[model samples]
Structures are given as structure tokens and as C-alpha cells.
Target: MKKSYRIKKDVEFQKVFKQGASFANRQLVIYYLHKNDQPHFRIGLSVSKKVGNAVERNQIKRYIRQAFTELQCEIKNEYDMIIIARKPVKACNYHEVRRSVEHLLFKTKLLNK
Candidate 1:
């Protein structure tokens, strides 16, 4: 993911956490806030130590970023989103992560038909 498309600051993440709406499945949780001025969506990812070691966590992050990249056109613009990975995600493959992400976006009404 490009730097411009990512939520990199602590304050930004905190803002989304405090003010955004969220949806989740067993694998991932999504926190999103509408940003009317933004021309496109930005995302932040979080994977805890409990999920796995560094290698596994990085792999999960990569899968999530790839999923977002592929789904960019279908996802709504003007939102800041944060994806939090849960323990179960360590057992999932890329396809499963993509599906989980797509499902959460659909549940949050952020995915366009």
C-alpha cells in the first residue's frame, strides 16, 4: 500500500477508534469513520503479538493490504479504516483473509455493489 493510502499516525488511529463505527467477524475487526473531504480511503492495520511472531504478523498484514488493493474500486472512498487482526487469523491463508475483509466491508456498508 502507498503511504498516502495508509493511516500512519497515532492520533489518526486514535481518532478512528474513538469516533468510528466498527464491524467484525471471527478473523478481523474493522473500524471506519467517514471523512467527507478525503478523495479516497486510508487504512491502518494492527496485529498483536498474541496473533503470532513477527513473520506471521507481517504476512497477515500483507494479505490484508493486498485484499484492500484488489478491492479498492469497490470500496467506498472518503473513509479512514483500521483493521485489527484477531488470533484466529494466524491459521488463515490469503484467501481467507480476503474473504473476511470483504465480509466486514460488506457488513459495514462500505463496499459498493
Candidate 2:
């Protein structure tokens, strides 16, 4: 994942949380807000402490990031995305996590045909 294209600022995360529309599934929650002229789709990931300890949380975040990075090219332009991991995601393997994210993105119409 490219650092330059990631949602690194606190304000960006907060804005998305406050204003973006959300899509929820068993494994993840996706929050998205359209941007007028974004350079690329920027993503933020959140895994709560309720999901696990630091190690488990980091693992979940890593899996989410990896899936997003792999799918970035297929995603459309001018959108900010935030993916929130659920508890089930921690126990899930790579393919499961990938599919969950992909499914949500597809359902959200972020991926072009």
C-alpha cells in the first residue's frame, strides 16, 4: 500500500465517520464519501480493541490493508474509504478476509465492471 494515497490524517477519518454512508456485512463495515477530484481512492482501516489485543488488532488491520491494496486498482476514483474490522475477521484466514472486503466493495459499487 502506498503511504501517499492512504488516509493518514485524523480529520479525514473523523470526517468520513461523521458524514460517509455505510455498508455493513458480517465481516466488515465500509464507510465511504465521494470526493470531487481525488488523486486516487484513499483508505483508512480500523480494528477496535474489543476485537482483540494489540497483536490481533494489528493482524486484522494488516489483512484489511493487504486486501485493499490488492483491489485498489480496480476501485473507482474520487472516493474516501474506511474499512472497519469485525471480531470474526480475526479468526478468518487471508482468503476469507479478502473475499469479505471484495464483496463489500462490489456491493457498494466502488469496483467498476
- For each candidate in turn, the TM-score is 0.98, 0.94
Instruction: Please give, for residues 25-107, the per-residue lDDT of candidate 1 as tens digits.
Output: 99999999999999999999999999999999999999999999999999999999999999999999999999999999999
Q: Which numbered prediction scores highest in TM-score against the true structure?
A: 1
Give the distance in Å from residue 83's predicted Cα in candidate 2 to where it truly belongs.
0.8
Off by over 4 Å in 2: none
Residue 65 miss distance in model 1 (angstroms) = 0.1
Among residues 3 or more apart in sequence or in different chains, the pairs in candidate 2 whose N, CA or C atoms overlap within 3 Å are: none
